[model samples]
Target: MATKKTSSKEAHHATLDGEDEDATHALELLAGKIGEPPRSSLQAILAGTTDADLVSVGKTILSSRIVTDAARIYRKAWDFYQEASDEQRKRLRGFSKPLLAVAVQQALALEQLDRKLAAKSTSAGVARAAHEKAAEAAQSRAIELRDQAYDALRDAAGRDEGLRAQVDAAFGTATTSETLARGLEQTAKLLRAWLGSDDEALTARLGLANLDDSYAKELATAAKDVRNAAANATNRPADGKVTQGALDRADGINVLIMGQILRAFEGAHGIDPTIPRLVPISTRRLFNRKTKKKAGEIQPPQNGNGPQPTGDGETLSDG
Candidate 1:
């Protein structure tokens, strides 16, 4: 008589029963707080991690300030959605999927929060758009990873009865990758903000000992000349020196420093600089540099000329 062999399915089930029970209890606790779908998705990820990695991610989800921040944003979006007029909601939906009103509301919240935080730091060189873009990229990647995990769980569930409940919990009604991704992205942004350093501070730490070369002197002289030229240019300089053509030809560096640097140049001659000086330019050339680099390959410097020790810091404003 031939005996039936214990199949792989049987083996998996036999081993997973205890594991599944533990996972289920953990899922219940997380689901109560953050919803079952994302919690299940988190479980899927945690299942593949070692004890150390699992502990780390668990702390991030549970203890990070950004997680609370994201939750607040989500609550605000939900409230806004509930209060919105039907016609406005309909118009918003026409703009995009996954409920446009919620999307825009959350986006605006994220942008405002990013700006507010960056403003508190010596991050004058860091653009608000840069942080927003970083968060968006993080969200996109997190969503992609979560969907992949869900799909794998679904395929496994097709063959194993034990995994079917997990699949259901992850992909059941009202569960969307977009929601999970937003939370994941907010955590990422907060992590990035904490890890980021101010470039000017770093430079000051490194010291200017290497900047005593003739090239440095020449560069400083050139910058001063350009500043003066930009400050005095009605069309061209009276000394027949080459002034910047128009706003269209000037780069971001030129625009930021031309008027202010020119003011400092006058201060050298005992002329006190005033606020709200104007630069003459008909066209403005904005920074639109593009590259083929991957995200995280390069990061923008997080530094700028903050208030000097003598409290003589200049504030540049648009007219």
Candidate 2:
């Protein structure tokens, strides 16, 4: 009677405990057969289950399904994230090369501009220095010339009386007109030689060679006038004679020649000469007309309206 004490529910519980190791294998086979669990299956299990063992089992199964679905969703999201990351990297790579090249080119352009600006600044500095040097040289030359002119004028004004007397005595006791004229000519020659010498720094400084055309023309005219005046002075009546005036005019002519020499120096040194207005050669011409032919050399006029020679041996006369 003790051996026959078999409770069915207790026996089932004992059997389930003994087959617990095979539960996972059995679930795998069942999951394959059912394809996948329905979304409401977990809810149905939660509602029906009341016993602690059954509820725990239902919860474990539902939790496993939820974990698997969550894992699947997480895997999909990871894949999408990877794909988006890959696309972003591709876009960044595509833009990076050109942007890097543009940055490099801009840096090079800025460097070149900086170099060019530095070179221009250096060249401008050199040009300015050169111009200043040239200006200083020109100014120095002007000062030297002014000093020389002042000295020459002062010396000429203070002619030595002893030298004049010695010169007069050397000519002879009786100073004839011909002897006096010869002596005067020799003195003029000496003066001309002194003034024309290159040793005179004033001549070089004054730029006499580059006289303006107007000034040169005026000097030439004045020279001609002086020569005419000198001739008139020599041939004038005793009362009409103006010896002092003639000498003064001659002196003026000499001064004009000296002025021309100064102008030439200025021209050589690239300076413009200060002079009177220029005169054209043809301005003072008395006759500038072209010659006309005489009547005897004129040609006779042709008479087209007088008569016409007709064709077919007939002549036509004007009405």
Candidate 3:
């Protein structure tokens, strides 16, 4: 039998078809295209494995001011159009006037919040109530616009079955991109809180708060270095613009931060622990003793009571 090598395109398609590793890679690629914070946040949300995860993810999505603003715009337009007489709606330009109206509403709501905020002086209580009401309405509109977008995309997909996957991927990318961006911002806030206080009870419990001043400063400095390096690395030109040394430096800092994030995550409870691993290129390398260090050194088994390797690379049985 001949061994068949899968092409990169085929592998990517496989991810859409449900291969775990490839799907994860596809998501990572999607995040990269979407940009940082959102990408990591999106990955974390996707990796969520419990009810608590869902709740955290939900809050992240709901609290996105951008999404809320977009929703409000669509809702305001929809509401205005709904109140219009049939003749008035007909007077609006375009064949798909209704759809155009919905899209315009999305754009319009960008300024809606500002206008509402500016109304604060006339009557504080009334302004607050109106603001809340507007947010609720906007949220509803956003949902409606979302449904409309889905319907349009799906309807087109039905006509061209071959494009279904593309359509679905596009829709998924857009929705997840927004959610991920919002989640990333939230995650940043959480990180700042964690690193802000040396006497924090949680840090104390984790035995991190007791670290000597020098060690703590070193850890903090390493984090800052990693962050700066990452920003530079990601912004590098695709046409071989950045030097190899710069890339290597970024890689080194990444390894440093990975350790810090994992250590912190293992001790915390409020956020998803595995979210750190979602950072772009944040992969753990398994120890390959055969290739590095000694050729004959024994390695301990991670699980099961299987025969262990002895010194000089021979297998030994304890039983």
Candidate 4:
């Protein structure tokens, strides 16, 4: 019998490129042969394989045009995600700064409300005291009037016929005086009641207290929100080494502190034309003084005399 002939490499290559189905079959067969997947079996086959060089073939496939296109697309998508995340962080920081400011303002407002309530309470007390004093004065005046009216009525009761008409007038005056006294007493009672009324006092106090409480709650909520935002910002991965948002916040804080300091200095200085303006003065200069002392002296008389001089030609001096 004739010896069987094996297929040549070039014959296999031609068969592999003949049709789509044939190419796929050829690739699957090569994959089993080399234990690796093929890239475009038809192209590989047209190149004509001589040995099972799957490693070199795979490296070439990866460096080819198709993989390069896929890598470019992936890089574009990753950059877009990074940009979006950066924008989101910036927005969060922007919102957080104003929210923190609002929280501080709310706390200040609550303090102001407390002061106002205290002032109102003080005013109420002063008013009540004034009312009491007025009521007392009215009561004393009423008592005096009543006593005078009684005296007049008694005197008129002893008068003659024509004077009897005047006595009736005195009786009317006495009645008016008693009515005035009753009115004054009632006013005093009303004032005392007003000052001691628990309901009214409680209502006023509660109104102010409620306002303060509400403001405190708002401040607390805003502070919590600010803290949460700060935490999130810190926890999130930053795109750059330096955070711009943090720097902006630090600048804002510095400005605010400077403004407050200026305002405080202005307030401390009284407004007077003769008063010196605010200036930095050295402590040493503020306390420094110069002085002279006399140990002995020769005196000159008021009379115009040609001088009396020392024998040594030294003038008498004070030291």
How close is every model to the real structure, measured as TM-score?
0.18, 0.23, 0.17, 0.24
- Per-residue C-alpha lDDT of model 4 across residues 1-319, encoded as one tens digit per residue: 1121121111222332233233234333332333322334324322432122221111111111111222222233223323544433343221222222332332222223323333444555576666555545544555554444334333423434443453333333214324443433333333233234465543354344342333323323333433344344334333332222222222222222222222222232333222112221111111112212111111233375322211222221210
Residue 172 shift from truth in candidate 3, angstroms: 4.4
Assess each prediction's global lDDT (C-alpha) against the native: 0.30, 0.29, 0.31, 0.30
> Candidate 1, overall lDDT?
0.30
Local error of candidate 3 at 126, Å? 1.7
Kindly report which residue stretches of model 4 are placed more than 4 angstroms away from their true locations once superposed: 1-95, 156-178, 181-319
Model 3, 136-163: lDDT tens per residue? 4543443443344344434433445544
Candidate order, TM-score descending: 4, 2, 1, 3
User: For residues 1-319, what per-residue lDDT tens digits would candidate 2 score against the true structure?
Assistant: 0121111112222333323224333334333432443445334423432233222111111111111222222233223324544434343221222222222222222223323333444555576666555544433433343233333333432355543443343322113323333333333333343345465443342244332334333333333433343344344233223222232222222222222222222232232222111111111011111223210011122463221111122111110
RMSD to the hidden true structure, all candidates: 38.9, 56.4, 37.6, 43.6
Question: With candidate 4 superimposed using the best TM-score fit, by how many Å does residue 20's alpha carbon deviate from the native?
Answer: 87
* Candidate 2 residue-wise lDDT at 228: 40
* Model 2 C-alpha lDDT versus the unseen true structure: 0.29
lDDT of 1 at 149: 40
* Error in Å for residue 106 of model 3: 52
Residues 1-319, candidate 1: write the lDDT tens digits.
Answer: 1121121112222333454344334333333433323224323422433333222111211111212222333343344445655643443322212222232223233223323333333232243445445545544544554454445434433455544454445432213334453333333332233224364432332233221233233333333433333333323213212211111111121222222222222232232222112222211111111222211011122374211111111111121
